[model samples]
Structures are given as C-alpha cells and as structure tokens.
Target: MTKTIPNYLRIHRGIDRQDSTNREQSQNLITSFWNSYSDATGWRIDSRASRKNNVLELLPAVTSETPQDHSDEFTPVVGRIAATRLATAASNLTEQVLRTRECLRQREAELASSAAMIGVEHDGKVSADQIEQSLADAMEACKCDAAALYMLDEDTRYLKARSVVGLPIERLENPPRELRGSRGDLEAMVQDVVTIDNMTAGSIDTWNSPEPFAAGICVAIKVDDIPIGTLWLFRETTTEFGSTESAIARLVATNLSLLLRQAPQAEIFDNPQPHQAIQEIAQWQYESLPVGSALAEGWRVDGMIESSESWATGWHHWDVLPDGTLMLAIAEATDPTATGAMHAAVARAALAAHSGYRHTPAQLIQRVSDTLWQTNTGEQLVSMTYAHLDPETGDGIVSSAGSISALISSRYGYRPLISSLSAPLNTSMDSNAANHEFHMLEGETLLAYSKGFATAGADQMTLGGHIRTAMQLEDRSPLAMLRRKLIDLPLTQERGALTLLRT
Candidate 1:
C-alpha cells in the first residue's frame, strides 16, 4: 500500500500533491506513504486549486462580499499565494546575493582606503605590530571576535603563532604553540581558545597535542607547495561560526603569507618606492580587533602594506599582521571588469561549493568590476583574499578573488581547497550551493597562489583542472610536489609564484 499524507496537512505544510495522495483510499494511502517513506522530508509543488474548494485549504477563505475588482484579468487566490511565496523566495535569494557582493565591495574599499594610507608613492613602512592592529580594525569591520597569525619556520619543521587580535596582547606577544599532540588536554592547555561548531572530537584530536584550539578553525597559508603559516579565529559562545566566517579568515591568511615575505616590519605608513627602482608594489594584511566602529559595528581590523617587484606583469602579493592574520592581493592578465566578475563569480562558487571553473583573462576582468573593467578595458582584476591557518588544529579558511586551487599538499598528494559558490556578482545565483572545507595533518603543507599561475597554461583542461591535479597529487613535500607537477605540466605560459608552509 502506498501511504500518503492528508491533503489538508500536506497543503498547509508545503508538501506537493504527488506525495499527498495515491490510488489507495485517502486514509490508507496516507498511512502507507508514511510507513514506507517516513524518512523523506516534505517537498515543494505548484498548484492553483482553491484550498476551500479543493478540500485542502488550511486557512480561512477570503471574504466573498467584495465585488470583482478587475475586469481585464483574474488570478485565483491560490495562484496569487503561490506567486507571492515564489516571489518572496526569489527576493530573499537576491537579497542574500547582494549582501554577499556588498561584503566584497566593502572589503575592497577597506583595502583601497588602507592603500591610500600607505600612499601611492610607496614611501610607507608598517611594522608587524601595527599591521596586526590594522588587521584587527579590518576584522572589526567584518564582525569577527579574535584573530591570530602563524608563520612557518624557515626550516619548515613547525608553524608558530606570531600575532593576535581581540585577545590579550601579552598572549599575542607570546602565543603558545598552536599544535599539540593527541591525548593532550586542550581545556587545560589553551589560554583563550574558543570552540567552533564544525569540529568533531575525533577530527580535533587527529594531529598535534590537545589540538591548538578548543573549536575554532585554522586556515593554511601556502606559497607553491610549502606551508607558510596561517590565521586562527575564535569567538565566545552563542555565535556559531559559519562557512563565510571561516572563508574570510582564510582569505586573511593568504594575504598575510604574501606580505610577510616582503616587509617584515612593524610600522606600515613609511615607505616609498623611488623612481624606477623595482616598481614598488603594496600588499595588505589585517587583524580583527576587539573594538569596532559604529558604522562597521562588531568589526575590527589591522593590516600591512609592503613593496615587491615580483610578478610585475601578473598579480602576486600577500601580507601578515603582527597577530598572524593574512591578507592576499593579486592582479590577473585579463580585463579588469572580467577579472572582478570572475572573482565575484568565484566567490559565489566558493559559497556554493560547485565544481570549480577555469578563468581566462577576459573572464576574470568581467567578474571583478563590471563597469570599471568594461570601461577602462584594462587587463587584471587585482583581487585579494584574507585568511589564516593553525598548526594546533588542522583547520582554516581559503577564500579568493579570481585565485584558484589553494590546497594542502600531503605526503599522499595535494588536496584542493573547496568552497561553495554563492550568487555570482551580477549573474545568476545559487543559494543551495554547499560551502566546502579542507582538513590537514601535521605532515601536510599549505599550497596557495594567485589565479594568474593556474591559468597560465594552454593545455585546455581549464586552469582549475591543472591546479586541481597538482593539489591532489600531494606526494612528498609541497615544494617538491609543486616543482614536479607545475614545472612539467603543460599549463599556460603565464608566470606566478606559489606560497607554501609545512609542519
């Protein structure tokens, strides 16, 4: 017997008619449906039948006393209701997409504003501590609680906590080793660590003692195949950290990883690249502060700017604040708008967790700044992502702007960092997209890079595919693995640097 749900309840609860009835007697059908498909949840359907007349209306009928108002057109009340519901859902989706896009714009504006502080002259120099404070201000702008930074030792044997925000400055000044051995008591060992909802007990104890954090995520920062370091995040109880929060953290990490290599200073507003001496470039770094501005209520930030001449043709740069948060910025070889649009699309994709997309210079420019890239017709999006990593716990974020294949390379192979695609900056959006994350172990290395590198080849698997393969083949150390896969891979001819850190 095929059981079904009662028509009235099903209609009221938003169940489709197909599952609400069957050939069997109405009661028997419902009973059998429940018995057979109890595990199934309700589904959606479209119908125009009047609830009162169709024997399924859960609410009172509209008063019929009112005379017919419109003569040219007539829409059934049920149809109107359905249309309204659909409109509401669509409106909600649009609002969400716009909100996410607005977030990107705001982040960019913050970076631009900070860049101005560094001056176009490139005469500014910010210290690591100042960078941490700036990052804290930026994180405050984003409503984050606490942020930290971890840098890989030159030997690549261990990752150390270098800076922190929203926590005790003393702790930030002298952060405890983030990684711990299994069976270690995290509660007793960790000073200001907070727990995150996503971590599982088994997974938390997989590597390092007690795990560095009680529940927060630690994003991996990589250049090429080496694990450079990470940014760590935490918040008090009551707020459940979601995928966006984690992604933002990872974005900060990537930025810092790149910046630390160039300017390991404490003050940021004091450097100028004179004449043609190595066309000076500026990178941004950040830390989330405890206090936030009213306009950016609940947010704080600290950032760094550095001068680098590497990849003058393509985009490449990252920065780290004193506390360990990271900031990453890159320029592509494509049109500006396409680059922005591509990044926007990538952000949406990361939010959605769909299969990756490969970008051309044209696509990248279109994605980042729809009007600017279109009007100026410049090639390159100049995108950025801020994130972090924690050696104590193999957890972190990996957000990007037109960047692809940030991954963890293990002895087994390289694993791509996956994220869900939200709504594209302007194109169609997908709210059902699932946000994805990558987990790492002690022997692993974080691999991060700009999109220019991935799309540089012409093999035609799409740049994303080439990078994906490299990440999956996490054999040997990250640098070694990167050299083997990227050096011989028939990717595009463009050049870009890879950042890495290993435990």
Candidate 2:
C-alpha cells in the first residue's frame, strides 16, 4: 500500500516557496487548508516534525482532493498508512504503561513481605541455625542474590560480618578487622563498586560489593541512633533501588540489631540464678555458727547474700592482708559501684586469707586505707564508716571517718559507741588508724550503718532508734528479739543496711 504523507509536512513545504515576499500569507493559506482537511477526515496535524523534503510524502490524499484517474489508488493507500501508524503508537503506549505498573506492584509486594518478617511478631529465629535461614528467606523474597548480616563488635566502633547467604560463612565469621582498610583484600574488594545496579555505587561514586556480586543495595543496620552493622544485597542486574525497598531493608537491619544486643546480657551472671551458688559461698560461715541452739532463731535470711565493697551490707565479706602482719576481713553488700570494687576486694581478700603469713589487724588496716579522688562532677568523696565484729567473738571493733553514728546497747538501755574519728582509710593510708574494741555483753545489741539509716523515709523507720528500742524490749532469746525487729521495721523502702551483733 502506498502511504500518504502527514498534512502538516505538506503545508510546511508549500509555505517555504522562494517567490513569496508574502511568507506569512502563504503559510496561513496552507495551514487553513490542512486544518479543514483534518476536521473532515478526523486526522490531526502535528507541525513539530514538518520538513520540505517530506511534504509530498506526508500530504493526505483525501476524497475531496482526489484527481479522477488516480483517486482510487492514492486514497486507499493514504487511509491504510494512517490506520497502521495509529495502531502501532497505541500498542507501544499500552506496553510502556503496563511495564511501569508491574514494577510498582513488585516493589509493594517486597515491602509487605519484609514488614511481615520483622513485624510485631518477635520470633524470627528459633536457633542459631535459624538465623541464617531467616536472613536467607529475606534475601530470596527481596530477589537479591547475595545478603549478609553484620554485628556491631563489642567495642561498637565497627561491624563484623556474622552470617551471610551466597558467601562462605567461614570467611564471614570474622573480618580480619571491621575497619575498611584493615579488612584486607577480600573485604576491600567488596567495598568498591563492582556493578551499576546500586545507588550506593554509580559512575561518579563507588562502593565495595562482594566477589562475583554485580549489583544491589547496602543498608546500614541501626537501632535508635546506634549503627550496629550493615545489610547488603547483591544481584546480577543493575538494580536501581526504590525508596520503599531501601526502607524495608533498613527495618530488617534494625530488628536484627535489637535481637543481638539483648542476647548476652540475658544469659550472664547479671541475672538471678538458683540458690546453689549462694549456699556454697556461705557454707563456711553457716558451719561456724552453733549447731544445736538456734543461732538466731526466726532471724530469717531475708534475701540472697549480695557481694560488694561497700560497708552497707554487713553479711557479705572479704578477707584482707597487707604486708603479712595486717590481716583484716571485710563484710558488706553491693552498692551502685560495687561490682568492680567488690571484685578487686575479693581478689585481695582471697589472697590474704589463703596466704601462709601471720596477720595483724593493725598492718592490714594501714594497707587497706582509702585515697582521695575527684568525682565525675569534680566533688570530693563522701564520708564512709567501717566497723568490724569478729565472727569468732561477739566483740565489736569500730572506726569512723566522717561517717554516721554507731550504737551499742544492752537489753536494758543504749549508749553511743565511740571510735577515734579519723580520715577514711583510702583518703590517707599513713593516717593513724582509729580502733574501738568492746565485748558485746551477753544480751546486748550493736549496730553500724551508712547515713542512709538516719535519713530513712519515716520517723518510725529510723534504723538506729528502732534497733535500740527493740533491744530495750529484747525477748528472753536473742533470735526472737532480731526477728521481732526485722518484721516490724520500715527500713526496706529507704536505702540503708543494718548489721546487728549480739553476745
């Protein structure tokens, strides 16, 4: 079929005639003719692509303009050409729109799946093996070829690859160094852009991808403001990532970071365990007490013994020896700063108690003194007090260093026990050690505590006064007296420790 040229090109050629001094008049006439023809034939003229050379080929051989002999030939050819071109244009537009819609649908499905995997339901991995399986499922669902999960190292400065799919797990187990440079050739190789598929890499900017990895996205795994590691997806195509896909990847990373952070703290000694360990630790002290008679009948061990360097808990203890002649023992409970200091004291105590050397309390007290140091706010240390009651004897020894008051009393009445007021041990190691020794006369009570006791919440909760009054009302048995006071006092809510001794 002979195809007629578009009418706009014919008008353009006709208007450009060199003889026309009236260029505007000629162009207007040609435009008017084409417009009238287009209206009658339902054809539209596009002037943008008009050219003089193509004018004859573009003009429509419409019925009204046909010559008598050639009309049959030209008209049918022009009509057929118009029909074919329109069908081709329409088909091309439909195909382009369909492809665009499909891309959107694929991205939406990927996002929904990612959200479901890491959604409110917390169980992603049931076992160590399942972690890899979960990550693999995410990668597969996302249509990424390679994926990796890295953990923030203990120092938190960098991320180390822990689990991966499409890479050897053995190599990912640990990167030589999480830092980019120190990660060496294999890691550094991956960091450089190896494919055109990712936004993180481009013609102007490059980032590493895995070996044999052509393209994909790399998203940082983060929780709160902390960046734990990275999640990487790799593929063969030059995959241009969309905003929604990037967000879904980041969400997966956050879920992974949260799970890893809590795993260790939950399993460690930081939490409560069976009483077996506590019982074993206190076995020696338990054996030293009287067997037949109730050592302190009804004097319940209120809670599990807690270890500390602070003198607040008198039940917890450590042995001390410095320069052989100084043998000392400390018993206390945990404070906010107790964990580290208690461990230090435990090491010192264990060595002293086990060392085959003569021990004098004087030498030990001298070595165990305190030292001054600036606080976080640059303030001086607070006052602290120390007192010792020999487990073997009911005798009490006391020392005070800008500390709370000490109380000594028999069943009938109470009196303040005095010790030479001196600087705390660590404040000045060479300072004179103050020592007060007195036998806990049978049926008498002795108490020493931190300032928390006096500052306790309620008037009736004053630890010192309560213990004194309880002693004054002491039952025939020492155990009954302690049990009565323990159950009756309001000291639990306020922060303080009370160590009671009776002969």
- The runs of at least 3 residues in candidate 1 whose Cα sits more than 4 Å from the true structure, single-residue gaps closed, are 1-313, 326-333, 336-383, 419-438, 450-477, 488-493
Reference-based TM-score of each model: 0.25, 0.33
Candidate 2's residue-wise lDDT over 352-416, tens digit each?
A: 44344553344444433322231122222233334444544555455444343456655556666
Evaluate all candidate structures by whole-model CA lDDT and list the values in order.
Answer: 0.39, 0.43
Judged by lDDT against the true structure, how good is candidate 1? 0.39
Error of 2 at 125 (Å): 20
Clashes of 1: 157
Per-residue lDDT tens digits of candidate 1, residues 1-503? 99998644522112122422321122343334433321221112223545453232222222233245742243334454554454446446656855764454334323322232322333233345544764685366446556655554444444454555655433433534534341122321232222344333444344342123334545555555344455555433223555676556555655664554334232332343233422222111112111111111121121111113322334333333344433233333333232343443333223223112443222332444453234343332333333443334545554444333355544455555633223222222211222234455654545444444434452223333443454456333334434445555544433444343433
Angstrom error of the Cα, residue 63, model 1: value is 99
Model 2, stretches more than 4 Å misplaced? 1-335, 338-340, 343-363, 370-397, 400-405, 418-422, 437-439, 458-461, 472-503
In model 2, what is the error at residue 16, expressed in angstroms? 51
The TM-score of predicted model 1 comes to 0.25
